[model samples]
Target: MLNALDNLTRLISFDSVSKNSNEPISDYVSSLLEELNFEVERTTYMDARGVLKCNLLACRRPLSSHPKLDETQSSSASDEETSPKNAPGGLAYFCHTDTVTADRWTGPGGDPFSAIVLDGRVYGRGACDMKGSLVAFLDAARKTPHEEQKLPLWIACTADEEVGFEGARFLTENSNAYTELVAADPVSIIGEPTMLHVIHAHKGICGMQIRSQGHAAHSSTDMGVNANVAMVPMLQTLLEIHNRCLTDEALRNDAFDPPTLTWNFGVSDGMKTVNIVPDHSNAWASMRTMPGVDGKDIIEQVKRRADELGLTFTLYSGGDPMHTDAEAPFIREFCELASTYIGPNSPEAVCYATDACAFGQLQHRVVCGPGSISQAHTTDEFIEIEQLETGIRFYEDTIRRWCC
Candidate 1:
């Protein structure tokens, strides 16, 4: 088997921060898969700065010369005909190549571009958050025993996950090639320093920016409407809605600890000077909700409150809620494998969102990967060497069981 940790070090060395560009890292991954003789497809998003940024979908089988067979029959024939040469019905391993900006902490370990291995952990921007899992999946594909069963495996290295899951959204809207998916994002793993746990569910997120407009004037003048001052009522209304969501028993999920809904006001605009009555003001807020509550409902309620306050607002970004049955066959199998390889009782639920929501909506059986959310996007971000090795083994074994 390829050394997963070594591969992880190399992956972490690339600076794929969300705002900058992931084209370099995406190129590296494409080259690696290409070297393995996998047919790579690059799906690029145009709006992103790194226009070269792409979602790399790699598979071992070449498309049929004639497009005449049904999906089931084609998959079956692919399995039988390519049994000795390639893999079977597509089983995809998905991960995002982009990361949140690494600007919080700076110093020796601050520069995320410089990946370092100290002690037994690999340190860099995307180490534990993601790049580690990407490497592990690639390593698994490289070393797994696919010749026996010859089940086709796909790797989806997407971009813009940190921003708004645009890459995943694009893939979901465009592709129907795979029936099974595994989103290798860290939060789903429950911030476990070990690879013993497999997460099956996570909350969904909805981000929004609210802007209000009015007439601008000096503080001493009451002739003009003060947009900044007007913001207070709307903010209060949102806070009330957020607090109500927290207290409402109906929104709570027994599966999650202290489950309800999460919201935070992250940013505000306008009102730069104390004496000026700002003409426009805006605020950014996000919500994390359980499967039962549609994010649209919450947004509508916010809009209703805004309307009641006579303010105008718009939805900057939004995402749907997702929940998959923990007893799903693939999830059960993965749980069993995790238990066998790492420990017993290995399933978990997380509160953060992931690309699994997108795949899950597409009816694909999805699960989270190894590593911890705690170490993600932090200074000196790292994943234990042991965790990396164990994750690779788990992935290899899982691939072998299903594909071989």
Candidate 2:
């Protein structure tokens, strides 16, 4: 069997960028899991571009399938055992198998897929963004003790996470596999770049577009209500809303960075030329709100404001916030395990979003993994060899804690 670093090197060799077919990586991972005696299944789906993709679910049998523990002995009491089983419930590792485009990653190597190891770091497109954690999880699973425990263990590698989380959505909406796996209310750990910090909360996301309509006419004629002019009031209203959220106690969550609702009106479209009074004008904006703050409610507020200004509004995308209780048993256990390496720390809330928001809706979930978010999408992205080893130990410990 390939070592963790070797597995990671093989994984990086596959260009599983978002929107591209991840069949190769899926095949590679499925083959590995099958070799390890896991019941591996793939939830195949087509991306927006109609490219074939998949979400892999590999389940190892429960500890009960192994020899029973002695009356006064713990699960670790035995040194000889068999492969794991996919019994009922157990802890799950959820990670996106897709990475963002590597257009900007111009490392010393010729290409992002080289997986160059220099200065004790693996430099590649997906090294820090994700593939690192997936490699660690795979390695830990390879090292798992066959001793008896109460629950099983699952690994979920979903596709299109960078492209609207379509893979996760499919798993949630279409797969009975996930339903069965989480039937026992197992804990889910989303493998994103958190530098091993246990992230318990994250803001929700909602994206919208507001359009203003008017009759087209020559600009000099003054014969039509300029759509651009009409759009100004709507933009001002959204700014006002943004400012209000900054000070609104109801929307504030001190645990997250900035501790306030964030609004970004970064896209707009309007008249084609100065000579024309635009027949239509539009602005695209997005908001990130604290957990427990409904993004739909914020959308409704925006819609109401648009209505007041006689403008049309449309919500194109959105996702719920994730907030696992800091005191959750799984969370405490994970933090304790992580603290041994990174030092003691409390559960944190990140302003950025993740696929955890998708799984968090169904069960207890937390976002914690190796590497740094700072290098996630940057050019020359890399993950330290030390972090990889740390992640391997961390995941191995976590797997043993719940699935001895």
Candidate 3:
């Protein structure tokens, strides 16, 4: 079991930054899963610069080959009938292997590729944000009892989650075997650093870049519409839309803090020099909305505002909101099983986005995993050793209950 943590430490030691190469980490994970008798599939993306990013999916079927039972036999059949080959359903576990740039952190402990441990914490980039959760899932799968009744387990470790969920999107579109999905990101569980929570819902994300066009001219004459000046109204309109979202009851989720849609204008760029009126200006913004809110409506509202100002703009990416029933059978069962290992009150909602949206579109019941969201993307990111062990136990117990 501890060897899994060591594997995680080694995974973090490789710098799989979002923009840089992830092949090393991907290859390492692929080899590990293969050694465990999992059938592995690899996917790679080539950037414009020809740098290759990679993702790995590993699947394992139980050792038994049981015949499908007739309707009359269903009630009396053993759990082995649900094994991947004979069962009508399957489950998938997903995690992103990429981390944000190490440059964001400072001090001697900040290097993302260097694994350090102090005070019982394994410090490194990607340690807490996701690699921790990823490793926990792997360990759980590895340690799960090989019973005849267990369903098949699929583990997907992908790239580009930090920059975007490209890897997850690709896997979902390409794979057709899974019936349920779990995203092992850190944000799902938030309680006392113990593995006691399951997240059933999360906000959806849409990122947009709005560019305003203007004619360049000298500042002294003001002959041309300054692109920067044009952006002011755009920003104000966005703020109004953001404020309006706060008042929308449909966007609110009682499970989340603040329980409303969130929008942010994160970056703006226009003129290169102060003395000149810029010909073009652009601003990047993102919206995080609850399950029922239409991200397209909010985006159109912004576009309408931009059109009213006669500003030319383009949208980059848009993501839809996702949610699963809190009372879903699988959710309830997983929550109950998690409680057996980590105690009760093991459910919550998150404001961040995950591949859950994609899986939800396919009608899969999605849930968040156990880890600390706060530790993600921070310097010296780490997951408690105890949490990993607890997660392994929970997975093992859940598989045993469902399969046997």
Candidate 4:
């Protein structure tokens, strides 16, 4: 527990904010992995401004097949089926090393990066949102018996998960560190704040922006068309679309709370002054589509509706929703391991999104970790001491079950 807390403190102090360069924290993680007798592969790439950003792929040396499993074992019998010797097909843990901006932190005393402990809770940015999981994973690796870990154990510490999935996108496309890992399609555990619950299904997110244009003229003139007025009906149409999605039985997925597509117009802009007719207006909306809902179809519907209103629309960005077989053995085994401490609980469907949505594209993935998602990105973010200890033990047990 103390070792895990120490690593968490060290990690939180680095201030690896999403908009800043992650070189320092990346180097620190690489150094720590090296000290644990793991070979580190750092995949470096330049961001839009040519600043260096990196993702670290570290795996235990002498990666091997499942020596602990019997030779006659089948894939149905165990999630860690035997693979070619030294192949990357085995247990892997994923976590984003970058954190959201801490400028909004309103906690008393020390700032977000102070890594302070108050009343059995560690207060800091990214403490619960995820630096704690990384620390727990590292500490667990340090305590694992070398001989017990017979299969490959890999860690992917990625960047740019907050603003965009660029880090994960780059790693999957360009990195050679885990070609076999992807090919083998190993069970992946994404460490996100889930209150130690196993998440097997969640909605995917995508966004679009609609811009309205009109000729600008003074209010006293009759030649002007109001972009704001043109946009109002389109906005109402979007609400109608939302209402339609809510009523569409075919678009429902019971796993999610609303069981339907959810949309929010997060940003809307128009005229700056009341006297002048606005020439331009735009609304940025986010859509969270349930798994099995065709995001492209939704976009097409919006496009057609916009065409009826004579409005131009653009898809700024978005990510697909993801789902893993709820009955997968790996998920069952993971939940079983967690149940030992926290008692039995079933896999849940969460509304929150994570890097798991990105990694789930390549493999079977589940999101589980200590702390609550409610605390993530809050002004006073924190992780309880008890949860941290439980997380360390959970990670240690996971390594033993899959690697050993």
TM-score of each: 0.85, 0.87, 0.84, 0.89
In model 2, residue pairs whose N, Cα or C atoms come closer than 3 Å (at least 3 residues apart or on different chains), thus clashing, are 60-85, 61-84, 61-85, 61-86, 62-85
lDDT tens digits by residue: candidate 2, 223-286? 9777777788777777877787878788777888888778788435544568877788888788
After superposition, candidate 2 runs with Cα above 4 Å error: 63-88, 147-150, 213-226, 270-280, 295-297, 308-311
Provide the lowest-lDDT 10-residue window in model 4.
69-78
- Tell me the alpha-carbon RMSD of every candidate: 5.2, 5.7, 5.1, 3.7
Which candidate gets the maximum TM-score versus the true structure?
4
Candidate 1: list runs displaced more than 4 Å.
1-3, 48-52, 62-90, 106-110, 175-196, 220-224, 266-269
C-alpha positional error of residue 312 in candidate 3 after TM-score superposition, expressed in Å? 2.7
Question: Which should have the higher TM-score, number 1 or number 4?
Answer: 4
| 221 Cα displacement, candidate 4 (Å) | 4.1
Q: lDDT per residue, candidate 3, 124-170, as tens digits?
A: 88777677777776776677655544455667787777666776676
lDDT per residue as tens, model 4, 65-126: 44233322212223342454322245788898999999888864558888888899998999
Order the candidates by TM-score, highest first: 4, 2, 1, 3
What's the distance in Å from true for residue 393, model 4?
Answer: 0.5
Scored by CA lDDT, what does every candidate get? 0.66, 0.79, 0.65, 0.78
Error of 3 at 49 (Å): 5.6
Error of 4 at 335 (Å): 1.5
